[model samples]
Target: MHRVIISGIGAEIPEPVITNEELVASFNSWVDTENARRADTGEPLLQKSDSDFIVHASGVKSRHVIEREGILDPTRMSPRIPARPDDALSLEAEFGIASARKALAHAGVDGSDIDLVICSASHHQRPYPAIAIEMQEALGTKGAGFDMGLGCSSAAAALHVAVNLVRAGAHKRVLVSTPEIITGHLNFRDRQTHFIFGDASVAMVVEGLAQGEKRPGRFEVLDTRTWTQMSNNIRTNLGYYTRTAQEDPYMINLEGNLIKQVGNKVFKEVTVAGQKFIVEFLAEHGLTPGGIRRFWLHQANARMNAMILKLSFGHDVDHDRAPMVLE
Candidate 1:
């Protein structure tokens, strides 16, 4: 098997920060001024100690990109002042670029070197060209590319796809990206699924660059396994646009509590499978969990991260580095 190593990385997020105050003001004006005031009824999470164990999480704080302000429904309502040009790419595309640039920068490689570009995202509706083409044009790449879907696992699976392409000789360099802008399709009235997602994207690069390169990096492609159970009939899925919210087309929906109950249960029940995934991932190089240096899991909240870490390594390991408490 050909060896595929991570060589260079880059990322780009939207120019919009949509700070809490701005969001509160914007969201308030959209709804009845009375109901808009409710958006902040729940105390803003930003005020709480960053170290406090998270509870009653809501999706509207921290960081996220907005297409524009003052023009709530740009597609329909033409606000006097328009949105910024960078917002033209839409939130998903914006987030995709965010991590793409970071990953490229990390690998010390420019976009020109990527031979294959893979976008693991779910919020694109343009039909003239695949988002990858626009991404390539954005990065100025002349590479073969495509897009894939796998919900929250899209990021991890994109890595697998990059390694496979390198090992199969289809390409020598690959850049994979995963981004979500679910808030674009959110229905504020649908409290069942609202208030759980933040917009973001990340990019990673794996290449067949010569092994003797200057800086050190990571390698090894184990295996990827997917499982579907009763929850598939109920919980577990992606966040994108909703026809129901067509008037508010850009909003995204995330079934927070539903995901929590189902995900926590899966975290508990999937221990054997999770361990097996670990075992198989290591068997490729005669290694195991102890041999690995990091575990980057995307937990929705601190509570979820704490529970999953306990499952993966008990409650003893340092989790400061884990990607937890997003949203």
Candidate 2:
């Protein structure tokens, strides 16, 4: 078996940005319109969203999105990404490739050096013709490519697989590409989830290391493990069947199918489970939370991460100890 190291990392954040004020204005406009329409129906008026509430709730001041015009348009609450021709490079593959190229450049290798490519993301534009395979061809990479998703853990899961493959001497180098255009699946009309997600793509190069060989500025893979338990607190029912379920197959339903979540449950459950997992994992390596130099926890929620770190370390952690990329 060989040792594996993360030789390089790269990311592509979209150009367009949406601040909480802009998001709230759009949401509240929709709420007002809906409330006006339901005035005589005896239905309760929809509550207006506030930028301050968004910040206090999720700690997100702003977010980068792949598109701006559509989402900001008070009439429409979704991003307007034009569908590309099948023959042309797809958006997901394009975004993944852009990040992958930077990762390859950082690793001092070409796309051809990557024997395997795994495109893992929270959302995939299509089910077939795997985005990874499309990226492989576009990058002129050899060997095999595929796509996989495990919700928010997709990128980490792909990295775990790449590390194991390199450790087993199956491949010299593997690329894990995550192009999450999650804003597309976001329900901008929903006050609870409107300001939560942003679009970004990231890539990492996992390579094998030989004995007596060393690479500076690279992280050595110590150990990798995953724990999973079924929960529906966070979910999205938008899928192929969504179109089929509609009375008109051509008509799309944007109400309940998009992303929705029980934020309180997720925050509580993840914090408890995440802290226990971190403590146990560190203990297995004869280490403690305080012994670690840095912690790169998920960027889902700032408060949840703080609570998890606090629970694991038995005290509140500093911002420098666990930097956040959510905003």
User: Of the candidates shown, which would achieve the greatest lDDT relative to the real structure?
Assistant: 2
Candidate 1's TM-score reads 0.65
Per-residue C-alpha lDDT of model 2 across residues 1-327, encoded as one tens digit per residue = 998999989999899999999998888888888998899798988889898898888889999999988998889888999988999999999999989999999999998888999999989999989999999999989999999999999999999999999999889999999999998899888888888889999999999999989999899999999899999999998888988988898988777888899999999899999999999999999999999999999887798899999998888998899999866
Give the alpha-carbon lDDT of every model. 0.56, 0.91
Q: What is the per-residue lDDT of model 1 for residues 164-230, given as tens digits with 9 covering 90 to 100?
A: 8787788888888877765554443232333345466778788764455543556545444455344
Candidate 1: C-alpha lDDT: 0.56
For model 2, name the residue pairs that clash.
none
Q: Against the true structure, whose TM-score is highest?
A: 2
State each candidate's clash count: 30, 0
The regions of model 2 sitting more than 4 angstroms off are none
Task: Give per-model TM-scores.
Answer: 0.65, 0.98
Off by over 4 Å in 1: 13-61, 67-95, 209-230, 233-276, 279-291, 321-327
